[model samples]
Target: MTADSGILVLAGTPIGDVADAPPRLAVELASADVVAAEDTRRLRRLTQALGVQTSGRVVSYFEGNEAARTPELADALEAGSRVLLVTDAGMPSVSDPGYRLVAAAVERGVRVTAVPGPSAVLTALAVSGLPVDRFCFEGFLPRKAGERRSRLADVAAERRTLVYFEAPHRLDDTLAAMAEVFGAGRRAAVCRELTKTYEEVRRGGLGELAEWAAEGVRGEITVVVEGAPEQTVVLDAGEMVRRVRVREEAGERRKEAIAAVAAEAGLPKREVFDAVVAAKNAERSGA
Candidate 1:
């Protein structure tokens, strides 16, 4: 923490739009004694766009070489050279590289700081209609369906809004798994290419969004799902029937709908089925 020791700066970059880059990022990029970037070519492009000249020695520090590069960067920091870490987008060490270097610096007692910039996670959450007062960031799900579903199941009862990152190619499959594990009626938002020219935010129930993603999606993506109802919210018969009807309206069969609704509401399928039947019977009697 002494002035004799250099600082490790973790700088955030624009996720999509270059203009979103902050002034502090430009200053860090230009002033650091050593710059460790996830993508050196991308860093070059960034500095060119920002009209900032990086006078320091720029080196690649991606996942592949971060282990090998950490010690070298640590040596520089110990020698009183300010080291700046930047990823392709967003903050380094956030579902990205730079973790190794940061941990190494911390172990060596080197000070660490950050130049906060645009973040896709925060941007998506802010735009998502879902409640953000309490939320969990699940960076990405497993590539396999079974593992992904199991992961979703673990958070099935999570009461905080959930955010996730997904590849464009796997967006459809991920959304489908979410619909299955969380129920089709669960509300979510899919944010695509935030801050970009084609930025799009699609908010709807899981089933609807799954259908939309099935047609294919492109660009960077972040998904935010609404949390389960609070434990205090009573899932009465009428409410149970309403949930079942919502799933059915989204193309689920009545029997399948009943099971999903029951699971989400923490009730038995028999109870959901009875409630649905009674609601229908009452409607018929009224007619």
Candidate 2:
């Protein structure tokens, strides 16, 4: 058997509490040949907490410098360096800047691994009291209102629970947009502060949450929305097609429209697709 090449270790740090840092993380930090941190200052603080001295070289790697730094890191890994990548919080390259480096390393056949520890996505989903068996991480929505709403239109039918991260100031607008796109009665939970003091989880319908958010919310926020309800065979198929067509006309592609319709109508994709196709063909044949 062949030995593995140098590895890219993606280390996940704590979101709020430093004590939450995994014990193995410190060992990796002390032993790694190259420590790539989002913020060197924070890395120093973490090292201080861990009381681990790094004998290897330490370098800054983040959003601004990621593109330029990737090749350098990849070279070190190629030279048999155990490259350890850490972000400000949570996992690296997860809505963070480590993707470039990871991609470059993977392309060169460098082994990639992780010191899995804290994750806001799973933490929020776990504590949100929503179904966690199946879910999707949406990260963050677009900042603009129109773009955000249009994006939400795609997941309106997602049956497996949905999760998202949102900014404090934009919480109200985001909740309102979700209410409009996902429906007023859709159940959701907003988790804030995570594992820190003042950690909060607000659970309610999209409409109520929107109203509450209008008063303002603070701290890091993660929102989990219940998937669209399953369709009852008795529901109107024609109505579902009409609604899906509306979304399609609003810049959503046919697949997205069909998905939305299927979710809303609580029907299978084939059923919705057949109805949509038949409706289009009927207009073409003038039947």
Candidate 3:
């Protein structure tokens, strides 16, 4: 690629501690041709903290201006300018405002690279005491109650660990919703103010965590919920019918009952229905 062939550099800013800033971050911040920061004021503080002076032009690239500013930044890169992107914290585009610019750069044949750094997702997961062998990053849960509950229900049976970002004010309600859907006894960890002075990681059943969060919480919150417990016994055809019957007796319609049982057993609803029907036929034949 030619020197002026435009390059997009995404840098990970320290989530909390300035000491975590990598040497390469300082180098790029000072030497890049253009720097796009989520918050220019925060960028100034970071530069000052790192004792690094940027010779590049600084521009805001937050959620509000990301759409309008994207084209301008892409043009800079196309002109062979080295553009560095830094979010307010954590990696860009992880529930932040870096995806659009990155996508724009890639579409225009601009080179894209990143400076590896601290990540709250990884940090929280590591310290969550939950299974990390397999996990999913869920970013932030939906804001509205109905939508949020619907979304949480979708993952209620997810077997892999889940990581999510949540606002402080809504932590209690979110945790409560998680408890209602995922189960009151499901284990979880809430890592708050990670890498900061008041950092805390609370681990407990979803029910207890909900109660705790109800008291009060502050700062950035990352939740790591343990996956559904491993099922020791696979549901045989007969057991599947019984499970569906139990749900049906509990006031669920037959269709909804089958679906609930199938979701719990990680099976298809049609499979559960056939099993229940087969069991009914066997009973009639024996009679």
Against the true structure, whose TM-score is highest?
Answer: 2
- Expressed as tens digits, the lDDT of each residue in 233-272 for candidate 2 is 4546577678778988899778767866776666776788
Task: Give residue 173's lDDT in candidate 1 (0 to 100).
Answer: 93
Candidate 2 residue pairs in clash (backbone atoms < 3 Å) = 231-266
lDDT of 3 by residue, 1-287 (tens): 45668788889999999899888999999999999999999999999999999999999999999999999998888888999999999899889999999998888888999999989999999999999999999988889987787677566667899999999999999999999867799999999999999999999999999999999999999999988765544799988988878878888667666755665776656787899888899999995
Deviation of model 2 at 16, angstroms: 0.9
Please give the clash total of every predicted structure, in order: 0, 1, 2
lDDT per residue (tens digit) for residues 1-287 in model 1: 65688999999999998998988989998899999999999999999999999999999999899888889999999889999999999988889998888888899889999998888889999999889899999998999876787677667767889999999999999988988878798999999999999999999999999999999999999999998765444689988988878888898767767766666766656777898888899999995
TM-score of each: 0.81, 0.87, 0.86
> lDDT: which candidate is best?
3
Let me know the TM-score candidate 1 reaches against the reference structure. Answer: 0.81
**Model 2 worst lDDT window (10 residues):** 231-240
Candidate 1 regions off by >4 Å?
231-287
Candidate 1, pairs of clashing residues:
none
Please list the Cα RMSD from the true structure of every candidate, rounded to 1 decimal place. 8.7, 3.1, 3.9
Candidate structures ordered by TM-score, highest first:
2, 3, 1
Global lDDT of each candidate: 0.88, 0.87, 0.89
